[model samples]
Target chain A: MSGYHIAIVGATGAVGSKMMEMLEEATFPIESVTLLASKRSAGKVKNFKGMELVIEETTPDSFEGIDIALFSAGGGISKQFAPEAVKRGAVVIDNTSAYRMDLNVPLVVPEVNEEALRTHQGIIANPNCSTIQMMVALEPIRKKYGLKRIIVSTYQAVSGAGISAIKEMEDQAQHMLNKEGYEANILPCSGDQKHFPIAFNALPQIDVFSDAGYTYEEWKMMNETKKIMADETIKVAATCVRIPVVSGHSESIYFEVEDELATVFGIQQELMIAPGVVLQDDPDTQTYPTPLTAVGKKETFVGRIRKDLDEDKGFHMWVVSDNLLKGAAWNSIQIAESLHKLDLVKI
Target chain B: MSGYHIAIVGATGAVGSKMMEMLEEATFPIESVTLLASKRSAGKVKNFKGMELVIEETTPDSFEGIDIALFSAGGGISKQFAPEAVKRGAVVIDNTSAYRMDLNVPLVVPEVNEEALRTHQGIIANPNCSTIQMMVALEPIRKKYGLKRIIVSTYQAVSGAGISAIKEMEDQAQHMLNKEGYEANILPCSGDQKHFPIAFNALPQIDVFSDAGYTYEEWKMMNETKKIMADETIKVAATCVRIPVVSGHSESIYFEVEDELATVFGIQQELMIAPGVVLQDDPDTQTYPTPLTAVGKKETFVGRIRKDLDEDKGFHMWVVSDNLLKGAAWNSIQIAESLHKLDLVKI
Candidate 1:
C-alpha cells in the first residue's frame, strides 16, 4: 500500500498542535503533511518527521490531493471549509460541534463506534471532549450489563476553552495568591457575554445556555451519547463544570444497569480488559486517578467504583483523562487510522 | 429573659473562629463567653463582642455554669468532651462526626429540620459541610414533592479540612504556578496515610475509605441526609471531592421527586421563599453561584435548576455555600437559636 496525504486545519490552536504531536506518535504511513491555519499563522514553520513544513492559509484549494483532513478550528471554519474539503474528495474528520448532530454525519468515538465510520458521508464528526471520554468509559459497561441511565458531573480543566483561557487562569491565580485583583475576560465561555475567573474556583456553566436551562455543553453530552451509542433509549443527564486544572477532565458518574444482577465486581472485570481504558481503583492502598495523575495520557482512567447502598443495580465511578489528548487530538487520529484500516478512503 | 453563659471548645480552630464571628453577627444575648482549646493554645487571647477572653485548656470542668457549648474540635476531642458537657447540664452543638450518626443524637440542619433540635439529648450534631447545603436546597422541594433519590458530586474547598489545609493549598499553588516542586501533606484526608496535591487538581477522596469503598465523607452525606430528613427509604449516593478553593463548597446534585407534575419553576418557587436559600437561576444573564461568590455568606446559593431531559420526575441543580459559614458555624448558631426559641435549653 502507498502512503496517503494528510492536512490539518487550525494548526496553531491548542488541540490542533496536539493533533500534530499525536499523529507523529501514532507513526501512521504518510507521504506528505500539509499544515493549514489562519492568515496570521500562514508562514509559521512546523516540523513533521524531521522535515520543516510551512503552514499555509486554509483556502478551498488546500484539499487538492489530501486523503484525510483533520479540523480543530472553530465551528465557523468547519462549517465553511469541511464541505469544500469533502467536495474535493477528502474525508474530513471535524473536531467541532458544527457537524456532530447532523442527520447524515456520524459522530464517532473510535473505541466505542469505529464501525460508524462506514456510513459517513464524507465528514466524520468527533464527539464533544466531555462526551468522548465518557463514551469510552461507559461503553464497556453498557456492552456487558445493558445500560439504562447515567448521571454525570464534570470537573473539566481550563484548557478545553482554548490556550488563552489557560493564560487567563494562571494570571488570575497569581493575582489571587498575592491578594490583588485580576480581570476575568476569557472564561466560562469566551464567546458568551459574561466571563468568570477559573482560578481556585468552580464554574457550573461550560458552554452557552441551550434549551431547558442546560448549557450547550451539557446538551451535547446528552444528545451525542444517544447518537454515538446508536441506542436512542439510553438516558443521559450531565452537569458540566469547569475547575482550575490545566489539562485533565474528571467526572463523577452514577449509572444504573438494565440488569439488576450487575455488581461492582462484574463491571470492574469488564473494564479491566476494555480497549483504551485503565482501571486504577484500589481502596486499600488509596489508589485512584486525579487530574494531576491523568494529564498527558491517552487512556481514560476509571476508579472509585462502588455499588449504591439503596439501588441494587446502581453504581458510581470516577473517570479522568487528558482533555486535549484522549478527548480531542488522539481520538481524531484514531478515527483517521480506522478509516485507513477499513479502506474507506483512497490512498 | 436574662443572657446565658456560653463556651466554645477548640476555639483556635477554623470553624471555631467562624463560630465567634457568627455569634457577634447574630446579636444573640450572651452574659459571658469562654474560649477553650488544647493545652498548646491555652494562653491565647480571642475577642468576642468587644470583650477579651483567655483560652483555657478544655477540661471536663470547663462546662461549669455554661448554658450552651459549641464544639468544633477533632472527632476525638468531641467524643471525649461532648459527653462531659452534656453531663454537666450544657447543651452541646457538635461540629464533628463523633455523635452525628448516634441514634441518641439528632443531626440537624436548621433550614430542613429545626424541629429535630427539640429532641436533642443534650447534644445536637451539625451535618457534614457538603451535606448541609444540599439539604437546604432539596428539603424545600422535598417538603412539597416527596424525594425518592439523591446523587451528589461535591466540589469542596480546602477550608473544610482546617486552616492549615488552606495554607498548604496556597503554598502548593504558588509552587505549581512557578513550575517548582511542592508537597502534599494535608489534603484529601490528613488522617489517611496518603496525600495528594489539590492545587490545580481534583481529588476524588474526601475522607478515609469506609465500607463498600465509599469515603467517610461520602458516607456522611448519604447517612446524614437520611437521618436529618427522617426518611430511611429514600436512596442516596454521593461522590465527595476536594478542589483548591479556599472557602465555599459546591455540589452538583441530581434528585428524583415523587410528584411527576413538579416543574423547574415549581422547584424554584419553593427555593425563592425557602429559609436560608438564595435563588440565582437566570440563564439569560448567565447568573449562578460560584465558590468565590458564596464565600463568607450565611445562605445556601442555588441555581442552574433544570428538569431531566429523559425522566419526568428527575431534576438537576447546582448548590453552593460557605463551608465554614452555613455548612458549619452558621448552622451551629442557627441550631442554638432554635433551642432558645423552643425553650429546650435552660438559662
Candidate 2:
C-alpha cells in the first residue's frame, strides 16, 4: 500500500476509538495502522478496513517506524510519550494539553491555522475540543471583521471527560428516574475532590479550579484560543460548564469586532461559507442547532446569530458540535490530512 | 379574619402549587384563599392552613371581594381577566407576561424594585422566571457600581415552560435511556410550531422567537431589566436555553460597570449584603451554586464571580434559583407583601 504509516496511542479510550472509526470512514489512505494503549487494554482486537488489529502496550519504541502518531490518552500519557514519539522521527498529533502551551509545538486547527503545521517540531498540538469548534465557527468572521474580544459560556457534555463519565451520567440519570440514589464518582472531573451528579443538573466547574477562579477547562478555552489564533491581543474569557449532554458541546458566545461596520447578516454569510461550519440560524422559521442535532457530526453548527442591541460591533451566537467527532477524533485526522496534503509528513 | 383576601389563579400549575406552598410557609396574613383555575380544574380541592378550598372556575366574577389576586396562568388568561380582577377592587400581581411591558403596569422584582409597586395602576407584573433571578443577583451591583451593560446566557429548567413541559422532559429522558423513540411536544414553547426534546439536550429557543432574532423570553429579559431598574440607558441582552433540569434556572452573566474601580471582591461584598441574594463563591474551596443545590430555594444564589481579564470595568458571575420560587411564586407573594407594607393595596 502506497500510503502513510499511522499509529494511534490510547486506541481503546473514547477519543481513541473514534479516531479508529475516522480512519476507517474517511478517505485517508493508510498503508498500515498500529493500535496502542496501556498494558491492560493490550491484546484487545479492533477491525480497520477488513483487517483485525490487536491493541498493543504503548512503549517508547512504538513509534520507531511510524510516520504519524495520534495521542489522546491523557495529559500524563501524552507528556510521557509524545516526546518519545517525536524523538523517534514520528510527527505527533497530540490531543492533550501537554504540549499545547509549549512555545516549540504548534497548536493547529486546520480550518483556522493549517499553515501552523509546517513549523511543527515533530509535535503538533490539537487545540482543546471547545476551542476547536469555536475556532471553526469564528475564524471566518475573524478574517473578515478583525476579531476583538470574546466571552463564552459553554454547555459541555459528559463524554468530554471520557467513557467512564458517560456511563456515570447514564447510571445517575437512570437512578434518579427510578427514584433511587446513585453515587457520583466520575462527573464534573474525576480527579477533582468533589463529585457532583450530572443527571438533570448543571455543574459550574469543569476540570478543577485553577488560576483566577477559572477552571482548567475554562483556561484551556481562553489560552488555547489565543495560541491557535496566534493573536494574544484578542481578549477572550470563558466559563466552562458541564451539562447532562452525552456527546455534543454547546456554547453561547458573545464577541466584538474591530470593525464597527460588522452586521449580523455579514457574519452569517461568513459562517455560511466557512470550512467545517454549518449555519442553522433562521429564528422566524424556528431553525437553530441543539446538542442532539449536532451529535455524531464533524461540522460545527452555528445559530442564534443576532447583533447585540446596544453595541454595533458586538454580536451573539450559539455554536454546537459533536465533542468526540469534530472536537477530537476528526480534528486530529484533519491535521494528519493537512500534513499529508502539504507534503510535510516524511514516510 | 382581619387580613387581606387573596385569590390564586392557575392554582393547579407548577408555579401555582409553589404559590400555595409559599403562602402556607410564610407569615403573610391572609383572611381567605381562593383557588381559581380553568373550568376543567375547578372541581379539584386543595388544603391551605388546614382548611379545604374548592377551586372555583376563573370568571369575571371570581375576583369579587378579593383584596389581592396572584395570576400565574397563561398570558391569554391574564389578559382576559386581569382587568376584571382590577375592576372588582383587587390588586393583580400577574405572573404572566401579558402586561409586563405595559406602560401602566409596574414590572417588579421586590428585592430590586419594590418601590415600583407604589405607582402600579391596579396591576403589577412579575418578570420572566429567568429575568427575576437575574435582577435579584444584579440589582445590588447595579446600585453600588453603576451597571452599564449586561450579556447573559441561561441554562433554564423545563418547569419554566409549565407542568406539561416538565412531564415531557421526564418521559423523553426515560425513553432515551431505554433506547426507545420519544416524541417531543410542549417544549421550547408549547404554542410554537415545533418542539424539541429537552432530555439531556439544550434547546436555545424559549417562548418563541420575536424581534431581532431574539426569543420573546430574551426580549422580556432585555426590556424588563431596564424597566425594573428605571433606567432606559442600561444595555441588556440574553439567550434563554432550556435544559432537562426539573426546577432551578442557572445564568452565566457578563456585565460591565461604569465604575472602573469595581473589583470582584467589591461585587461579592455587594451581593453578600444584597437582599434575596446568597453569595456562594469560594473557588479555592470548590464552592459554587448548581441547579440541584438551588432547587426549592426562594433566594437567588450567586457564585463563580470573577473579574474580566481584559476590561477593568467588566465582571462575570453565575446565578441560580428555583424558577418556580424566586422566579415566580415567591416573587409574586413578595410583591403582595410590599403592597401591604406600602399601603398600596386597598380593600
TM-score for predicted model 1 compared with the true structure: 0.99
lDDT tens digits by residue: candidate 2, B215-327: 99899999999998999999998988888899999999999999988999899999999999999999887789999999988999999999889988989999999999999
Q: What share of the true interface contacts does candidate 1 keep?
A: 0.88
Interface RMSD after interface superposition, model 1: 0.6
User: Each prediction's DockQ?
Assistant: 0.90, 0.87
In angstroms, what RMSD does candidate 2 have relative to the true structure?
Answer: 1.1
Q: Which DockQ-derived CAPRI band holds candidate 1?
A: high
DockQ-based CAPRI category assigned to the predicted complex of candidate 2: high
Q: Largest DockQ belongs to which candidate?
A: 1
| Tens digit of per-residue lDDT, candidate 2, span A1-347 | 48878999999899999999998876657889999999999999998878999999999999989999999999899989988988988999999988999999999999999998989899999989999999999899999999999999999998999999888899999999889998998877888787888999999998988888889998999999998889999999999889999999999999999998899999999999999999999988899999999998899999999999999899999999999999999999999999988989887
Tens-digit per-residue lDDT, B123-218, candidate 1: 999999998999999999999999999999999999999999999999999999999999999888998999999999999998899999999999
